[model samples]
Target: MTPDAAQAWLEKNFAPWVLALSPRVTGIGPGGAVLEIPVTDAVARVGGIVCGQALATLADTAMVLACAGELGEFVPVATTNLETRFLTAARGQAVRCEARVIRAGRALIFAEARLSSLPEDKPVAAASATFFRP
Candidate 1:
């Protein structure tokens, strides 16, 4: 799908909580997508740290949309497994979640995502997920 189409899907199909996190779709391609979430009081937990749960949810949501882009349209899918690892805390600035499809099969898809802060070489969190495509 075209970048515009991906952006439109991000705006339309993402969950209300995900949308409230204010993620912006920066790029979309056959196997990868980039999403940026601005740091705000609402998205952060106590002490102004970005919540790990939000990061995980963003990763999963972005990967689903990326898979949809690669398929050229939306397909109903359910998460079968999701594993998230928090490497560090995100304190300031926006965090970027980059998701890539590892593989896609007839009934399942595998994906990975990295969440990092701007100019940081290390990821704050990483996630691997499997989705049951229907």
Candidate 2:
């Protein structure tokens, strides 16, 4: 889907709390999506580092879009499982996530994602997840 369509889908489809992340789809492909997440003080932990939970949210949400993009439509999918590894503290005000669909089938789909603080050019977290249409 186009970036504009993706943004509209995010606003209309996600729950209120998830919508508050202020995700903007920067790019999308058949099996990938790039999203920018706003990092405010509210989402940051002590020492001004963005919290892991916030990054995980970004990763999970991005994977959903990545899978839908591969399918050429936006459809409801449940995240069955997500595993995240925090690499380093991200100290920026904006972070980006790149999610790629590792494999997609009739039932379950697997994806991997990377999170990084923008302009810092270093990864802060990595995630893998499974999703299924429900």
Candidate 3:
């Protein structure tokens, strides 16, 4: 999907709380999307570190965007399941989320993402999610 289409989808489909997380759609291409979530005090848990719940929510949202991008528009999908592994703490910088669809079938889609504070290959959080597509 195009970047503008993705941005519209994010604005229309995401939950209010998720939107309140202040995730910005940085880039969108077929089968992939990049989102940046700024770390704020409200999103941080203890010691000024980004919360795991926020990371997981971002991951799930990114996956949905990826699947929608791959489909070349928005398709209503629900999160069937999501698994997240938090590897490190995200401090001051905005966390970037890169998500892509690994495989998509008629009824289900598999997607994965990495949340990182750096541009390097390392990820602070890794997530895999399954979606029930409409």
RMSD of each: 1.5, 0.9, 1.5
Question: Candidate 3 lDDT, tens digit per residue, 43-63?
Answer: 988787889999999999888
- Distance from true position, residue 38, model 3, in Å? 0.6
Candidate 3 segments whose C-alpha is farther than 4 A from its true place? 118-122
Question: Candidate 1, residues 1-134: lDDT per residue as tens digits?
Answer: 76677777777876787789888888888888888888898889888888888888888988887788667677777999999999888866888889999999999999999989765645789999999986
The pairs that clash in candidate 1 are none
Ranking by lDDT: 2, 3, 1
Error of 3 at 95 (Å): 0.6
TM-score of every candidate: 0.91, 0.96, 0.93
The Cα error of candidate 3 at residue 28, in Å, is: 1.2
Best by TM-score: 2
Candidate 2 lDDT over residue span 61-129, tens digit each: 999999988889998999999999999998776989999999999999999999999787689999999
TM-score of 1: 0.91
Q: List the residue pairs that clash in candidate 3.
A: none
